[model samples]
Target: MSVSSVDDRQRAARLLLRHPLIRSTDEERYRLVRRYSSDLEEWFEINTGWAMHADSEVVRLEREPATVADPTHPFATRRGGAVLSRRRYVLLMLGLSVLERSDSQVALGRLAEQVIAAGTAPEFAAAGFSFDLSTREERSDLVAAVQLLLEWGVLVRVAGDEQDFVHKTGDALYDVSRRVLSQLLVTRRGPSTISAQTLDDRMVAMRDRGAAPTTELRNLRLRHTLTRRLIDDPVLYFADLDDEESAYLRSQRAALCRRITEFTGLVAEIRREGIAMVDLDDDLSDVRMPEKGTEGHVTLLVAEFLARSGVAEHFVASLVAHVRSIAPDFAKYWRASALEADAAADLVATSLGRLSALRLITRTGDIVRVLPALARFALAEPTILGGRKP
Candidate 1:
């Protein structure tokens, strides 16, 4: 490839990785992808086993969304965290349903009324969900879900503000980007069509039915799935892989890494326990480790503790204890009121959640196994008195 061609491919890769869904409103990035649409699509399909879709209204990359959640990711809003609480998640689904029924221009109050009616209906009430607009918490939650949609480009703000609704002061207006709304759900079946009652079952049933049934096709999908994981995650542990996946990945790992490197400029960092696509440029990932704050300090502390000799696994209770013991010294500097607790267990939970999300550690129930990547975080060598290399 020519120099410019290589740069364009990398730019396309970075754009899609940075913002997976590029709406028309994302003017600069959207235009960048538009100019390189063919190249981006070709690169994405050949390298990551995914598709890059582009049109006048939007540009999107189709890939399996990550299940991990971090409460402090920068892409998310100042108020919103990386992880959505269960209540907020339910509200999000409710908001989507409402959006589907809304016209091109959506009025905030109208949407709230419809959601309240549906949520308070006998069937929904029987299911244990209640929507009372009078309650500040309920209002805030629905607004949070709507704000999330706004951030995702599914709904564009044309008028009023969501903060008004949250404060019980006023309502907002929005324009529904139907093109973007349609692309929000990556599932094959609508929620109404699914027979599953629980979220997990429904999620499983929502997989694209177009997937071929043949064994050869299934094998192809397995390869695609594994490749996508490498491109998307910091690491892929063998313990997390299925038997067939492990076998396929073991045999075709080098080929997969080469294919990805050619397309996205990502280098493979392979180890015995897992494989990670190391983007030395740091342009691909949405989250980072060893951040700067109390959370970062706590993570470093935990990583150091785990990386130390004789430490194999960490328990939630033990981690909580550690955080509680040391929280006082850092509580004054902590930015989040949520983390400024007397015990700071929640802060510990958030840190561990982030660590797990980064793939530096694996969590099963209460126990966390520090992965190989974290070994590199060992405390820097002590500096000598003369500022000489130690």
Candidate 2:
């Protein structure tokens, strides 16, 4: 397709939502983006309230409160995942700090040396953090951090193995992707000047550094926040929008919906109550209904039951009972969570959580107020009509 084609815009929009679309990994996308980089940047910023970081080898969109965690995926496995513990997070940041001062092509030995040197400094002593390369476990943790960097496109392996470094057999060399490294610092200002004693305080100080947002800034924030919710979230209800947001949505819903559909190929199914962008692709979202396994069966069954029952609200106890009652039917194939002591409760929670995530049900405490979107999922059992015999 040509650079300025509708197809290009659609692909770009998908990539923007699914970033860090690295040039190293996806050179075709990278080059296409680079060709029409200016337009894509403007479109993303104007429509979604996200900043696009484009350069020679990468096009990354910075989404704040940078949520990268996937409950379904393990911590170490997520290429763009968030660090689990404060200790590991500190190491990640420290490693990044160490990489900042190094050459374009940095050696593993040099990087670790810098990290260890920085850790033992009098300043970072509060964390009581130290990395001893002599210890295998510590070395492995460091390697984990480096591996994460590789996934991030911040570092590309030149000619060495992290396992070698972990085993103390040999050092490794990595060609730092400078474009990726440049966008790594999330904040405009470093935390050196912040007079905050604790991490929370430091974060707050950093957040509050800029001038109070003007009306334009406030509007941008609102648009971006709401757009993110609509895209990432399963539902957007009119009742959920604030006074100002409600007003904005009312005025700009058409324009907003049109742009979203045009760019992302999602059809906006609007109603008096709320709006949802129906993904025809069906593969963009992590959670899927009519899925397999114990969780999937329970979700579909409970959803069907809830839709058929037409209850405005339900207790967890009721769902639990339903799950226990039906366990025997599916228990033969799905043995994992079928017969556990807390099977009923766990199944109920999982099913309800999935339903809630999909915007089919709203859970207030133990009560779930089934929403209108659920009417779509009401399935009719097959009827045995003997037409040929007749």
| Model 1 per-residue lDDT tens digits across residues 89-177 | 77787788888888888888898888877676677777777777888888888888888888888888888888888887888889888
Off by over 4 Å in 2: 1-4, 65-87, 106-142, 163-171, 187-221, 290-292, 305-324, 335-390
> Per-model C-alpha lDDT, please?
0.75, 0.75
Tens digit per residue, CA lDDT, model 2, 11-67: 766766666456646877777667667877887678666677876566777654312
TM-scores, all models, native as reference:
0.85, 0.75
Which candidate leads in TM-score? 1
Predicted candidate 2, C-alpha RMSD: 4.7
Off by over 4 Å in 1: 46-49, 66-82, 208-216, 324-341, 380-390
Deviation from native of the Cα of residue 2 in model 1, angstroms? 1.8
